[model samples]
Target chain A: MSIASILFAALFYLAAITLAGGLAYRIADYARTPAPLKIPTTPAPTTTGGVVFRMAREVFLFESLFKSNLWIWLFSILFHFGLALVLLRHLRYFTEPVWSWVVLLQPFGTYAAFPMVIGLAGLWARRFLVERIRYISTPSDHLMLALLLAIGLSGLSMKWLVHTDVVALKTFFLGLMRFDVEPLPASGLLYLHLGLVATLMLIFPFSKLLHAPGVFFSPSRNQVDNPREKRHLAPWAAEMEK
Target chain B: MAAEITAPAYRVIPIVPALKPDAMEGVKPFVASEKIQDALGFPGTLPDDWHERAIAKMGELLKKYRSLKVYLDACVHCGACTDKCHYFIGTQDPKNMPVARQDLLRSVYRRYFTLPGKLFPKLVGARDLTKEVLDEWYSYYHQCSECRRCSVFCPYGIDTAEITMAARDILDAVGYGQKYSNEIIGKVHTIGNNLGLPGPALENTMEGLEEDVKEDTGIDVRFPIDVQGAEVLLITPSADFFAEPHIDSLIGYAKVFHAAGVSWTLSSMSSEAANFGLFIGNYEQMRKVALRIRQAALDLGVKRIIVGECGHAWRVAYSFWNTLAGIGAGADDPYALMLQKQLDQRHKQPTHICEYTWDLIQRDALKFDKTKNDHLVITFHDSCNVARASRMGDEPGGQFDIPRNIIRAVANNFVDMDENTIREKTFCCGGGGGLLTDDLLDLRVKGALPRMEALQAVVDSHGVNYLAAICAICKTQFSKTLPYYGFNMRMIGGVHQLVSNAIILENKQ
Candidate 1:
């Protein structure tokens, strides 16, 4: 194994373990912390099925964001959906034989980069332009935006501007997924994209990126609006009741 | 800082301007007096170990409330909720922004709890739990009415109210709490209501209301008290006994009960529905206040408990009462089981008054003379608690419609304020979350600005003379601040007041 390949493999391993383990820990913490009250934001769906539907609209459509602001909704949804497609496209590299669905999604995912870049730019601009947004935004917020933009731009550049050895790149990612290590391709843009992606993964569980899993645990969203139907006593609260 | 606020004489919907950071910096409500704090089972003064105690309390709360921890984790500082708060809009205080307000505690949470915050505090906007930060928490958390306005807008449904509650709980744990909320919570504990209205005072007030209604409509409506074998126990706000428009609504309840021929009694023990413990965000305190209702129900032998028109009280009654006092079924706890066995199982145990009235109206059991309200052009102000926190009927959006339906049944001219300003997106009346005291008058006046603007909008196009709301706090807040906006204080009336005016007696109809 090349030195570069070994280093990259180790970095990927650390990031993967950290991301998965940290998420599990955070999720366990959330699950254990009891919601003593039924705090579903009202007009919230009452049943489990309805809650699923509400979450679907929230996660997929950014329904609440859509209600809040047209501009933030447009950029945020575009960015998230575009990121989804781009992430899906990258799944091809990790799979031994590219899945048929992934093969079919290649063209659409390639175009998704355009909106992803544009969306990140718009979101970034709002940080500096919109006064209230700018006020609430911290240096880390701007830095996070820049990091995402850099990742997207770097990925796009390697695809469109500077063609990389795809066969070598796939081997590298697949090797990272498997124990078999491969020689790392000496492409600057590919390295940039992979490095930034690794950075994002490493920070995912610790940073505000936890919002991805945090959304599901949000009592305001996930709680059933049936407080009047059943008593919702957390163990600690139930102890108090006694 | 001592009553320096010269409130604007004319209503001004503050133009969206550049974010002026720290606009509400010096703005803080007076602390709860030592006696008041002691009365509520809180410390009389800040303890020597307050820092440790406060941090410990935050850790304890972080473990207890999933909403608090989840909200703290979920906020990305995306600023989606920055401009969503009415106080932020009214005061132009960046800290009043829901996200900024959450950050007041989030920064501290990050420092003590999260790894990134410890390693790189400034990088993630994390700060240590210091005295200054505690002061900021005191000021800003009190400013938040816990209305859940920003929660509706948040993509992740990050409830800043949850954060605010946790912060207040932390503050209270450290012997620092606002006077208005603590005083009221203590009063409810001691005298059964925020007004400190004892059984005799309440009885006198009810007698006066009955006579007033008799004079107006010649209906001998009886406001019964602690009558055994009554079918319903009406848990209402004490303001309904002490305040105007609220008292009118109390009369409306009496008339409705009189018309429906339903036996209902008011318990002096749990006389109040407005639980100020909710304002302080102390679960034990909230639960203690709520338990009175269950005890009252058991003592008075009431099968059903119907809540009167109060915002946060309905939210508590509808949302937390089941958990706290066992109003709902399927509780493993013996206390819950005790109450559950007694409450009527066929209907919702604690029902909203609007739902009750609407149910009667739906059944065509109640008749209203709409022409009686012809002198008043009314608009509905959806109280933040009922709008966002609780539901009315079995169906969703019933909270919005039921009150309007009741109004439509009673009144001829009804116009909703700005569409964006009503329903689940309703703004607070600035007096909620226990900021209604004379000391917080400036904060209350400024915080009332967004709501004032919406009310003004309706007045301009629709000539809305009466701003009918279901909250005692809303009625009280608007009664004081509406005159500041050049509207008559009489404009702040309850939905039930309109119902009282137009409710046709069985003999007359």
Candidate 2:
């Protein structure tokens, strides 16, 4: 395999794994904290069908997203969906022959990548423009967005602009999948993209993005609101009071 | 002219025999004893299954979900929540500690759900769900009024109220509920009222109220119960029928309706506005309790239902009524349709009782006869349920202006408590969430101290004779807890009383 191709493939895989591992650790740490969840009670059992509907609404419609500032919602939806689709398309690199459908949809994938760049830009602008959003946005938020944008732009450049040797790239990935180490390729842009993607994944679990799963576990949403007729006593309390 | 005999000069004689001296004396002692017991602490006993069921339920719920399991798993044991709680602030007891309070549920949660808890329980502060643990939860969770104040300050936003509520629900499911809560729920289910005062009692009370209005103001204001075709069904807590402050508030609503010449009726079926289901964590019961008001409105064909000045009731009414009643279904529920129609028709929006009362007093320029309320030197206590959860921040329920307006109307010596005592920052009465029973008296007293302290500030400065509160539970708590704390203040009549007292008597000849 060409040195440049091997370098690019190795960088991407390393970045993704490193990011995912870091995010998982951060999420575990956050889960340990005693954050207050003070959602008002409703007399509906969260598990009783309503919860499924609510979950669906949140996932598909982004119900709370819709309720949030409209511009931010638009940017978030585009960026998230775009990022997800691009990741799926990248699966061709690991496969034996470039997946036929992915090959056919190369143009569409490129088109989708464009929105990832635009959406990230819009979101970054919004953080600077809006008061409350800006107030809450930490330095890490801006850095994360910048990294993702750089990753998307670089990937787009590699696919459309550079047109690097495909056969060499494929051979390099196959070697990596087989645990064969190859020498570095001289694609500075590919290395930059890989680094950005790695950083984003590393930061994911520590950020508010962990709310993706945390919302389900939130006591405000999960707990049933039937307090008028029931008596609740904690065992520890019972002992201490006694 | 000076010697003219006035109408056949009959000798002065009593037309009817007076009560026997012994009988009259006997009636006084009977009344005095009942009053004394009510005023003093009367310790009541819980049922035999109360403790067992509570523990079992707590264990069962802890076993039900991994989310709760995770929550129990997640506690870092920060005591930051302690000072944030109004109850703990009011009461200096170590048990009032928030972490200590949450440990009531968390320890059992840990013992039953976590791996470390199951294998090496002592390592993680985890203990088995014993009867002692259940009793502690009941005591501490009950101490929490579920006001959500601590949650606001919690950095991670760990809501102990949710824990307490979850524990309460598990306890209720297991039949370890409080008597007052259960009995009230039963009454709400059976007779459609919390007090179990059936249709006859409701009618009798309304009729008596009519007579009192006639005798006092010569206005002959008719309190129509179960009157069909009324535009509004005014639902109030049962305490309004018998409780002092609430009764006055009831009269104020009647006066507003009378003055507005609006068609309204009181539902004998769903008389009570306070729903303990909200406190106990029973959704079905909460729905059933709320359903009564909607049913009454539907049965009577009223366009809208107006809930009275009860805190949780308004919260339930505003937040859950439409969802629970299946309102907005295409012709399946006429209540929702009628409510929509009423909303569309009204020039003024339908509002909380507070807003309505306040608006009327402002609109009419109603001058209160200070002499009528001379007995009261008043300060207001804002119920937490109303001040925080309900729409008190912006529009102040329908009667937002009512409490302040009413106090000013009735008492010549009206006094303001601390700045935070009235609006958004008001402390909870601590007896909300069905904690008004004798079993929770200590917690209730402690919880009420912040509020009591605020009131005391006003009382000391203004010599306040009465603490005006709108919620029935708040009234009950304050009425019981005030004297215990050496605050000689009584619950002045609700805002409605001021309206009834101050409104111009139309029949004044």
Candidate 3:
């Protein structure tokens, strides 16, 4: 196959999948019904400082995270950190000359990919093994984990086992990032890895994985726990009260 | 055919006495119209700026909580939380459904703030803030009891209650609070209680209880009020002062204290345990109401405050009093610090009302005269706020045994409701979330139907005569609602009421 055609195929396939995934996410969010309204009775701090402190406690310290099972907590931290590192490393492919840090940590990236794969596997296993966790896990949960593992393994294989022309790969990735048409080089393992990662990114927002950011927006954990002592009328109840 | 074989026309046998002419004179069946007019200023035209002011206040309140702002802005409307509500399960009304209910608050939030909502309102499913939408929010939000039951099942734990509360707060900010609620708030501010009974009235009530104690127990139980230098101040709801069931419960508290020989007095100023501010989403009001208890405790020179058997009252006392009253700063607040200090200072350990009450009954192997309560076949209704929200878990009324004990103590014919009726799955009385107003009676009756039906199922077979409930409001609601549903069951008092009836008074020579 011609180099230009291969590049074009990879670029076009990635964009299509990304767009499809993004649309699916938007649809799921729109289609999903909201849970029932529950008014918590706990006292919440009313000051701006109080609210900021609470957010900080939640985001950085995972204040509520301590409430979850220990094993789940460990796996979550590992998987999230590994996933973030891997995403950072992927930026290496889109640069003309691979970033200096990416080059320096090429070995570290390979090592980090192993844990990322293992962490995803551990999480999937734990979900299946734990009865309570298993009950809550949906089909999408298992699929996301399996897909993540595949992407990590394929990327590692392309980097460590199968030799790919680095210059050709960089050119292909940069072209895709810049919205230019380019064909991928005939690097079989690279295409497989790129295909898996691209698919996962597109599916990211739609899946339960979105809970990572969604928790912050949840009212139960975020709102202050102030009890109502004074009588305030709900506007609807005002007329009835009068 | 033998004459015996043919049953004669059945004669109506009336076993009970005929009703007296003035049987209904003093009985107040919660009237909504009067209360609505007196407290809420309802039916009258609201001020011209009311809507604008309320919406503006809502926006400001939303802005106050950056976290709430994010949550209100971030909801993807995934309906996974729909079937998780007890209210929705109890009532199939779509308005009672959480998603539809939350949409009432979320839509307004979106229209006011979000960029896409502002630019392309239709594209985002956002609509302009209208009176119709406001009415829907008002109706449905009130339907919610602010129970966190759904949060337990939610994947993201999105609390719909927060939206409801915020909505109420905004309404209050705009001068649209309900009459009953506003009146209660006014009372809490002015008289230190929702009931609006002042110090002299409280003392008089205590004196009446003292006389009742003398009549019943022979022991001249001093129901002291605001007595300085008392070791502990027992704070309870005003319902205990005059209300039927709760009054007995209050006496039960005094008896336990007397039995244990613990030094405690009721503070006339802070007789109520319930903090109504919880219903309206007003934090400052909550603090002000809670402050009375702290002030009373300090003024009376008590070492500790023992909250009474009120649901939300106990919740506020235990949960927030320490924080808001400066009784405790985080873990090291004054309530805790004082409690610890008391534990350390006293040569003997002091007991909480729950601990002391349970211990006294258990320690004495207290026997009851079932004949005193034999007039009714009673079934216990576990108050959701008390059984679920409070410290009670499994050891009897911590979750299970207390009510069972109380029921068995009262009537020989005590029968159980369905298993879910007793414990973790106990249904609310529908009067909670401050829906006890007369206008909301229909909704409350509808909500109480599930519990009523369960009670009726047993009453149909076993023939329940009385519905024993713990919380005062539950008792009040049951007394009114049960009769409406064609069930002739009387609202029996709490465990303490049973204790008062059953406990043999020492013979006065």
Q: Which 10 residues in a row give candidate 3 chain A its minimum summed lDDT?
A: A228-237
Candidate 3: C-alpha RMSD to true structure equals: 12.9
Q: Number of clashing residue pairs in every model? A: 0, 48, 51
Residue-level lDDT of model 1, residues B205-276, one tens digit each, is 778877877788777888889899899999998888878878889888888988999989999888999887
| Model 1 error, position A154 (Å) | 1.6
Better of 1 and 3 by lDDT: 1
Global lDDT of each model? Answer: 0.87, 0.59, 0.60
TM-score of candidate 2 versus the correct structure, residues matched by position: 0.61
Tell me the spans in candidate 2 whose CA falls farther than 4 Å from its real position.
Answer: A1-242, B1-78, B110-127, B326-350, B361-377, B392-415, B420-422, B489-491, B505-509
As a whole number from 0 to 100, the lDDT of residue B38 in candidate 2 is 24
For model 1, give the RMSD to the true fold.
Answer: 1.8
Residue range A24-54, candidate 2, lDDT tens digits: 6545543553322213322224234665565
Task: Report the poorest 10 consecutive residues by lDDT, candidate 2 chain B.
Answer: B23-32
Model 3, runs deviating above 4 Å: A1-211, A216-242, B1-56, B63-91, B328-352, B361-379, B392-416, B460-466, B504-509
